[model samples]
Target: MSWLQLKIDTTKAQAPVLEELLETLGAAAVLMEDSADQPLLEPPPGATPLWDATRVIGIFTVDSEMDAIIEFLEAQLGEQLPAHRVEVLEDKDWVRAWMDHYHPMRFGDRLWVVPSWTPPPQPDAVNLLLDPGLAFGTGTHPTTALCMEWLDSLDLQGKTVIDYGCGSGILAVAALLLGAKEAWCVDNDPQALTATRNNAEHNGVGERVHVFMPDDMPDMQADVIVANILAGPLAMLAPVMAAHSHASTHIALSGIIRPQVDELREVYGEWFDMDGLAIKEDWCRLSGTRRA
Candidate 1:
């Protein structure tokens, strides 16, 4: 069946309200994208980030009266609605369409993030088969790539790893594939926990990776710790991360822009000897060892 798609370009501040208006106006589904093609970096914990200029698209039945709906929208939204367009959309394999944009990505050497549908580019390398979902961290972002590259350089065999703020469990699973004896995947969001679990199962490392919420995380020292959360939370999580690390623990942190590196180094320096920063585009990763 064909669907009527209504698209409206608006500011980030108005996008949420327009989505609600679309729902109230009988929209079956609504999606939002960046109108300016700006990439949204990872937000602080508990925050949902959006682009400055957002394009909202709502779908409805093609049989619906669009003129009357447009009139209602005009009344409710007025000048705030900006401009809109309506088009007919024929159903197709949306999952395939989305997956088409994602290809196998390699990090460092011998580590690959392969979409579940695609064959690994390097069969001899360690490949992580993943499906993108509600959770973040598919290795596409520089933050995730930095963490994976750090993980690749480590000797993880027989080590205990902690993937703090584990989104999609990609890092934890990668550590396992790299020979970590076990990994703990911790995140505050339930969807993140679910996504991590699902991805771990997909990689056949579910048994080796344990999932938890921050409040429920086990108290134990880990040989390695990796967190790709933003700088704000990383600053706040310093004590928590330190408490979970011993003098020998190796730590890697990402999701930091260049300007934030100095502050992060200062914050983590209390418990770790912060190493020199690694740059990927505008993003940076900080590696350090726990202080004795």
Candidate 2:
């Protein structure tokens, strides 16, 4: 079925009201875009952030009465929208559209995170079968890439690994596939747990990849710990991670921007002799061994 897409430019204050109006007009879906090229990053939990100037779009069945819909909206709003346009939208597979945008991405020389729908370019590479979903760590971000490179360089045969703040269980699953004996995956989000489990199962490593919340994490220490979390939580997790590490344990830390490196270095310095760092596009991955 075709859709009637109506886009209107409006102030932030009016966007919600217009969206409601569009819903009443029998819109199947409503989308909002920023008129200004502004980004909404790290919004407060459960809060919906909008731009100062927003472009609201309403999608309706092509057969709907567009004239009556516009007339009702204008009468209820008491003023016409600054700008508006209606266009016929041919039906397309949105899932395929999303998949086309995310091709198989390689990290380091050996590892590749390939979407389930796309074939790996390098057939001989150690490919990780993954699907981009609610969880993070898709291998597109520099932070996750840095960690993957470090993992590829490691000799993890028969080693036990710990993935703190494990999003999608990418690191843990990758470690298991790279010959690690087992991996303990920890995350606070329930969605993350589900994502991790599904991804692990998809990769045939579910049995070896154990998922947990921070509070329910195992008491056992690991041979290596890989944490790809922000600097604040990384710093706060210092002692907790240290308690889960031995003097011989190797730690790889990412999700750090260049400017935050020195602070993290000082914080983790108390427990590990942090290596210089692996720099990639303003992001840094720090690796080191636990202190004796």
- For model 2, the stretches where C-alpha displacement exceeds 4 angstroms are 1-91
Q: Which candidate tops TM-score?
A: 1
* Clashing residue pairs in candidate 2 (N, C-alpha, C atoms within 3 angstroms): none
Give lDDT tens digits, candidate 1, residues 1-292: 7788888888877877888889998887666667654333233334554567788877888798988888888788775348888888877433344466678999998799998778888999999998665467878888889999999999999999999989888999999999999999899887689879999999999999899999999899999999988899999999999999999899999989999999999999999999858999889999999988
lDDT of 2 by residue, 1-292 (tens): 6788898888878987998899888897776767762222222222235567788878888788988889899999998866999987777532344465578887776888888777888988888999765467677778888888899999999999999988778899888888899999998876578879999999998999889999999799999999988888899999999999998899999988888899999998998999859988888898999988
What is model 1's C-alpha RMSD?
6.1
Residues forming the 10-long window of minimal summed lDDT in candidate 1:
37-46
Q: Ten-residue segment with the worst summed lDDT in candidate 2?
A: 37-46
Model 1 TM-score, 2 decimals? 0.73
Cα lDDT, all candidates: 0.85, 0.82
Per-residue error for 30 in candidate 1, Å, reads: 13
Q: Model 1 off-target regions past 4 Å?
A: 1-92
